[model samples]
Target: MQKKGHRDSYTTNNQKGTVAITDDTVKLPKIGHIKAKFPAKINGLIKSATVSKDPTGKYFVSLLVETIVEPLPKTHSNIGIDLGLTDFIVLSDGSKVANPKFLSKLQHKLAREQKILAKRRAVAKADQRKLSDSRNYQKQKVKVAKVYEKITNIRKDFLHKLSFNLIKNHDVIAIEDLNVKGMVKNKKLAKAISDSSWSTFTTMLNYKAEWYGKKLIKVDRWYPSSKTCSGCGHLLTKAELPLQVRSWDCPSCQQKHDRDINASINILNEGLKLATIKTVGTTGLA
Candidate 1:
């Protein structure tokens, strides 16, 4: 059960039997022949349909369809990705994708809108009127919701494109299994970490890799990818590689390392080892 005044969406299962779709309309069980815009041609068996109303008062229907996905042509390329707040991702091949920080970019605008919302709410309260009945308050509420919706859509778009390109280009992709939940416990970094949306990116990578017949190897969270020397297999002490240290020299090999790049390389090597083990175990090979 959802909390009162909080439920904004519901789903209908077995939509194949109850729902019908035409080029320009959708027929739900109760709602008959609602005109809808088709973003693309729907060419699959409909399993379920979700109807949702956003805080901004926009209604959307999402159809879950079962369809065969054709895998992309093989690139035979592999890459390791190190996710970070500074750069969204650092590739083992020395490439970096900048963190877009969608929330931070629009934070000031959101705050301005939210300030109006708060004032409107106060006005309603001062007038001894219920918030639900206040027109101005509702309007400002929608404005705040629109800002949040914009941020979410932008972030999802970036993640989808990045994940799709990585899946399309790499035969095997390796990424660290970060302890995001634990990492966010740090109050100072929580907001930035949430804005980074690492979990969403990794989730995208996981599903897309499977859909495209590719491999996604997750290096264990415990692995000290950042502290290990990618070139010489030497591990640095925790004191030697503090959180603020961005670059370092390997003591044993005297090799220089850009922290994120070295971590990505190490993650790739470890992922390859894990893949080899899995392959050997599956094939019963020496």
Candidate 2:
């Protein structure tokens, strides 16, 4: 009751927090002057900073540094990456990122804890009737929390590695702008789509591109990236693309399509066109 009801006390009694600006040492809330992993070296002046705890209970300090990175001579060879269920990511550069389905493998353990948590919830409610101590209930909650934490850590590690590799190697990366909400609504392939981790991949790619002096291109969600024939640039008029159809030849172009690679090429071209427009002082391009 106190934990749930005493919101005011929680904030008021929190330890003092301060952001460490560039060249200025500021004391952290609980931990004092811990050195930053890497000083943000930027072209311009330093700005405000924010520190927060993530859902997995990890504390992170975010430095908002004022900076300008002059883009390198444009590579002119932009590549698009298609996130996948089986292969994880298929890049136009012919690079493949293997899908390590962390959640699927951990489902049994997660389900076990969830089942236990459900049972504990019932017990907690019964105890509420008896006005009993919540020590065991709290323990069960922690067990469930630990499983979630493990899942999050696995995801973070995978994303960081994937993002770093892409940013390091590619000059301009293009991806399909995914409407996760809309994709989730399709119950048929929802699990596979979620497991593909397109949302996470896009988010990581976006931030990493900024940090690594790479350009990110986000094509429209509705754009027929997948259905378009990469070689001939012909649109596919198929009513439905089955999940099982890994490769197909375009009816119009007769070009064989490796589904993911075809999508990646379309994304790449779209990104290249957008970059050209931006360079030519166009704010909006149709």
Candidate 3:
């Protein structure tokens, strides 16, 4: 059971043999063939479908299918990723991906629409009318929802493409086991951190690596990847490596380091050690 005015969608389980999908339409139980546009061809056997409606008044159907996925060709390459706010990701190979900041790009427009919706809600309450019965409020609500949906779709698209590229080109990928939940507790950084969507990006990397038969490793959170110098393995004190310092010189080796790239390299080294241990344990070989 769903709470009143809470759920906007429902799911149908064990829909195998009860549902049929074509290139452009889906046949569901109780509902006949409905015209739908799919992003790509559905190739596998459909097991279940969850039909959902967005606040924008658009209906969507998600099909769970069983299919065989072939692994990508081996590249014999490995890399580490450092996730950040200014840059989306910095790789151990010295390449960096810029943060798209999808939410920030549309913040003003979204704010304007949301303000209008709030005013409409106030008007509806003043008239002693249910929100569902208020046409203006409903319309404005859809507008606000559309803005949010746009941001989500754009962000997901970017993450998927990036994750796919990394999986396809590399045999092993290492990333930090970030405590995003704890990090977001900082009031000043909460909005920026949420907008960065670090968790979503990592989740994409995890599943994509599995699908491509690639290895994804998470370095321990307490490892202090950032405070260590990649070149000479020199560790920095907390006072020496402040948050504002993006680059620094190692005292032990006098090696110049870009903070994110140095951290990524450390993650790569640590991940390789972990991977070797895992392999030896599984194979029972020294």
Candidate 4:
């Protein structure tokens, strides 16, 4: 049987002696009160708290905060986003946000650290030293962990900022529902696809849209956004609009289209249609 990595965590409920919270500190059973920074104010009655440690050896406490948030004022502007490997996101407005491949950029550094860690592990193994008892091995392991942690933090920060901006400014946002798992099956594109982090971005858009009272529409993945001509609505066969052809003139309308931008426009239109249909159905019910 394969061994599973253990998860480090403990939970405490809101009792007089168990867990307590103040403006800038958290109190645990035997640890007493520890000073902590609050990114946002915690509202509502004291709830249960779960303290967990991540692979990076950093500790985090998750508080179940029951709070109400007022929705921001509605914005009339809407947008469509096309996720691609070349650009992180191409918006319907013709803006291309370059992909900051954090992991790719730091691959060399990570490889160097892993090399050192491997040497340490090998020495420990050759000497018949237990890995748990090898101080050097453990130290090198943490070094490797820190690199991974940095990459995760950078990607998360970028995604959160981008998602927040979209939700704050747009009334409705449209994106293709990507089959990320299936797409990653291609050996050539798997690394690029994973680095793109499309799934995480869309997930953030989904929840943030709900929290901010904005609309997030997911067009079908199989919808031929790329092959359809935005000008004349003429659909091109897969052969005519192959992946290699990045730009082309529409035969039906004779208008030139930048492949990704044109696809974003199509996505925007489809999203608007879906939003309209939903609104009509809701009004009819009311």
Candidate 2 residues lying further than 4 Å off, grouped into runs, are: 1-77, 129-132, 240-243, 282-286
Q: Write the per-residue lDDT of candidate 1 for residues 78-118, one digit (tens) a residue.
A: 99999999999999999999999999999999999999999
* Candidate 4 stretches greater than 4 Å from native: 1-5, 16-18
Q: Give candidate 1 regions above 4 Å deviation.
A: 1-4, 14-17
Query: By lDDT, is 1 or 2 better?
Result: 1
Report the C-alpha displacement of residue 235, candidate 3, in angstroms.
Answer: 0.7
| Number of backbone collisions per candidate | 0, 0, 0, 0
**After aligning candidate 3 to the native by TM-score, how far in Å is the CA of 56 from where it should be?**
0.7
State in Å the error of residue 187, model 2.
2.8
Candidate 2 weakest lDDT stretch, 10 residues: 5-14
lDDT of model 3 at position 175: 95
lDDT score, residue 79, model 3?
Answer: 100
Q: What are the candidates' C-alpha RMSDs?
A: 1.9, 5.4, 1.6, 2.3
Itemize residue pairs with steric clashes in candidate 3.
Answer: none
lDDT against the true structure, per candidate, is: 0.92, 0.71, 0.91, 0.90
The residue-level lDDT of candidate 3 at 64 comes to 88
Candidate order (TM-score): 3, 1, 4, 2
In model 2, residue pairs whose N, Cα or C atoms come closer than 3 Å (at least 3 residues apart or on different chains), thus clashing, are none
Candidates ranked by lDDT, best first? 1, 3, 4, 2
Top-lDDT structure, candidate number: 1
- Residue 6 C-alpha lDDT in model 1: 61
Q: What clash count does candidate 3 reach?
A: 0
Better candidate by TM-score, 2 or 4 = 4
